[model samples]
Target: MAYRRLSNQSLVGVLIVLVGVVLLVDTTGLYDTGFLLTYVPSLFVLVGLYALVSSDFRNVGGPLVLVTVASAWQLVALDVVTVGRILRFWPLLIVLVGLSIALGRVRPSVAEVDDDRFDLVAAFGGLDRRATSKTFTGGNVTVAFGGGELDLRDTLVPAPPARVNVVALFGGVDVVVPRDWNVRLDVLPVFGAAEDDRPRREAEHDGVDLVVTGFCAFGGVTVTN
Candidate 1:
């Protein structure tokens, strides 16, 4: 039998369903699951772990920060530590940043890949790329303490919807698509913002549908035509 891995989209849908179920059960007042909310921060730990596994541990900086912040908050929520105590260790972020830089330098660099799909990363730098693939598929973009731009105005997707995951941590990403295309933004912003700045059109065009989804922590992702 062939093994099939779950896509992030499916995983997110499952989580949403589960959350709805939990909320429904809570409304009945038969059992108290309110305490479970305290563990909500742990979701970031899961996200970090997933990112590590999915990227074969190549994408580290942003995920590591997510896990660290979530862990600190979890500890405080559980009454295991106080907010004051955690604040004292906040300087460790500087150390983590240094480690991330060192690890990035040691990692092997990848040459430019096919235009159909890409895995672009901008860590402590800037990245600008344009996609012109006729069979344009979805791809990923990660920005950590840096900026990135993915211009797909000249690209043509064979399919209707292409899913692109963008992660911005202490940085920002700009996605430029064709004016005729429609964008579905489902990104989560934590102390940040994600905006779709495309001009409103009265009639829909027969262009590709782009689904932009991911996390923005202390950063932003802007989609424009």
Candidate 2:
């Protein structure tokens, strides 16, 4: 009476199998199912929705925009909307981006020390921050058309689990943590990548467990020791 959650690999495998079956059906002239292709754009919408639910709505702006665009694309494909009509509202994208930036610039949840938490944003520029907090908590990072680096190697996460939420759009963000700590990466990449290049620890240590969760669009997020 219990259902096990599907892993990313398992979900991808299922998707591949479904796609193959559809292709086979179409190739063999079983049925005129070409109409299903019109729903391809909806995949992005689904991804955005999944991200929103997974992150508990803490990260919204980027995913919301992605969902909006994908929905528009799907409408166009379904002949419910036209490309010219969508073009007329192109400036709305800029307004949304501005709002996202403004909303993201906020203080962290807790600030026990001067450097316990931080929020960094880099747009059309670069930001380099080094945290030396003895009890590092958590923070947020945003990079759009720029790059950022958060160095926490000198810090100590006395609190077992510290979370960092990141959003990279057409840019990159690098997080450098201690070599002995464990990293739990839960980032979503859309036409982008989020990589952990840190070497595995041969032995386990009772150190901080960093949780990096966010989404990247046409960009990347890298974690290293």
Candidate 3:
């Protein structure tokens, strides 16, 4: 038999049927212990179907279902699903769902430009820079600029350290360099502080240079090595 897609309304109807089934089973005192475990997969299927059918779903219901399922799974995993606990977490879950839906509406466009060097610019407010052609083997590279963020974390290659230069106008920045690589940071007057929590020196390895500059009207910056 071939699989068939269910509409959002049909999925909701199916969910209602499943809930009725659970209620009937509970009243009969049969397999009561695994009720939630048995229903979670069904609920996930219904939510997935709902997300597929409704174009406006992701902007509204998708996040709500996701947060609800995640919360339920956590509670079931910890074996702590009491009525009071569920009630207490419900409001927080609603807030998370609402926030996710609101944020999803603000979509940002990303573009990659290639030139003489490995230049990656996510210009939200027209900031520009050129990255040097250095071998950045094993390290984490993170660049956040102008309400946009970029992270190249946990590279498995075993090459030399990396160098990064960034400029931000009104956003946040965070980067993590490898412990073995040597690193230097230069920030312009517009750029804010260079916050790093890594140790002064590590074992045998060289760091890289990390320079950041911007007009951070309401921006923050961070870099680590």
* lDDT on C-alpha atoms for all candidate structures: 0.76, 0.74, 0.44
Tell me the tens digit of each residue's lDDT in model 1 across 36-89.
777878976786666656555555676677788989999999999999999999
Question: Each prediction's Cα RMSD?
Answer: 6.8, 8.8, 19.9
Which of the predicted structures, 2 or 3, would earn the higher lDDT when compared with the native? Answer: 2
Could you arrange the candidates by TM-score from highest to lowest? 1, 2, 3
Residue pairs of candidate 1 with colliding backbone atoms:
none
Report the poorest 10 consecutive residues by lDDT, candidate 2: 105-114
Minimum summed lDDT over a 10-residue window in model 1 is located at 107-116
* Sequence-dependent TM-score of model 3: 0.33
Candidate 1 Cα outliers beyond 4 Å, as residue runs? 1-6, 27-30, 55-59, 79-85, 101-134, 137-173, 177-225
Q: State the displacement of the C-alpha of residue 7, model 3, in Å, after optimal TM-score superposition.
A: 46
Question: What's the alpha carbon RMSD for model 2?
Answer: 8.8
Tens digit per residue, CA lDDT, model 2, 1-225:
999665433443476588788878988999867888678789767866765564345445676678878888998999998999988888888887777567556623212224777655544445566778888898877666667688888788777688988888888999889877788888999999998888864235554489898889999999998
Clashes of 2: 0
TM-score of each: 0.52, 0.50, 0.33
Q: After superposition, how far is residue 157 of candidate 1 from its true place, in Å?
A: 5.2
Error of 2 at 188 (Å): 18
What residue pairs are clashing in model 3? 181-206, 181-207, 182-206, 182-207, 182-208, 183-208, 190-214
